[model samples]
Target: MYVVKSPLPDADLKTVADALQGALVDLVDLALVAKQVHWNVVGPRFRSVHLQLDEVVDSARTHSDTVAERASALGVSPDGRAATVAAGSGISSAPAGWVKDSDAVGALADALGAVITRMRQRIASTAEPDPVSQDIFIAVTADLEKHHWMFQAENA
Candidate 1:
């Protein structure tokens, strides 16, 4: 951890930073998995699903950057390397072979939903000790929930 003399205690910052790092790992993995879906999707609605996946990847990347920056600001060095993400992310591995548009939508929705659930927990964890971190997670949760809805709606 680097030097950061914030109002929040060092211990609290460390805890929050750890949580944010975990979030970063998951978001990075999600971004990669979304791109995998984008590349491998096939069906009558292939073009639409393929395009929609780009939006998901964009959102995941945005959140990953935000989360990593927050951790760094708090004096924690976030590990976003592919190995770190693969080892630490909560999201499961996507299928290797080509997938139907509906299947891709379902898989991405499930992955996003899992991360959103975990984000809510992270938000609550920081509610008392670090409200700012909580707010960041709240914002991320809203974005993820919106994406989850879109993916589910597309599948339907």
Candidate 2:
């Protein structure tokens, strides 16, 4: 059942793999949530909110790829399937139906907050076992935090 071999001991690999998988699921779900809002967002600020949602989607997609690739490189199979994301993601489900501009902003900010919280935990968990993975978590956290700030500002 071992397709690839990881350099780290079983204990370290397990910790790193768990963090990577969690990050992958969250990022995938985050992208899906943002895209859902982008398509359904309505209201006076729709244009700007719509565009902002795309930025979040793009960043999530990019970070998910990086995390997945890192997992693969470390000999762990990354599962980004819809079922996996639905079952394992830390992000809450997006609201169904048309989302108002303000609602969309709030939703994304909240989703990003959830993901960032887990990302911080991952960052800490991976710090000693795998600084490489920790670095990725840090970068991803920075981007998600920036998006959260922008979305919160939209409500201001």
Candidate 3:
């Protein structure tokens, strides 16, 4: 396990680090779910939805890496265990079986939005705040909001 020591207050760093790890876990799970939808989605708008899902999943992966790196920078090992992430993630599990393309898109968007909200809260609460983590959250949130808008547009 690699840890990077920080000069910030121990309690603040520990709390922010834990939150960052938790957010990373959620991001990983959400990324996997988005990819699952991307691969399985089928319908008239398959091409469009498929491409959008791919983009969203890619963004999630990028943000997850950044968040995990931030945690390591703060002297904490980022959580990568599937079970740990599933347990900590606020995103709901996808149902067993193929879902309609629209529903899949909606589900993924909802999960990502929930994560974005949580990340925003955590970023604001960090005491000797990590700017890198905050920036990652900002970027991820914008991507998620775009995903949400796209999915909603598909429904309209």
TM-score of each: 0.95, 0.98, 0.89
After TM-score superposition, the amount by which residue 134's alpha carbon in candidate 1 deviates from its true location, in angstroms, is: 1.1
* lDDT computed for candidate 3: 0.78
Candidate 2: misplaced stretches above 4 Å?
A: none
Ranking by lDDT: 2, 1, 3
* Model 1, C-alpha of 32: deviation from truth (Å): 0.4
Write model 1 residue lDDT over 1-156, tens digit each, in one string: 257555778788767977898899889999999999899999998998898899989999998889888877776788999889889989989978999988999999999988988898899889888888888899999999999999999867
Error of 1 at 82 (Å): 1.2
Best by lDDT: 2
Q: Score residue 36 of candidate 2 by CA lDDT.
A: 95
- Worst window of 10 by summed lDDT in candidate 2: 1-10
Off by over 4 Å in 1: 1-6
Q: lDDT of each model, Cα atoms only?
A: 0.88, 0.96, 0.78
lDDT of candidate 3 at residue 117, scale 0 to 100: 82
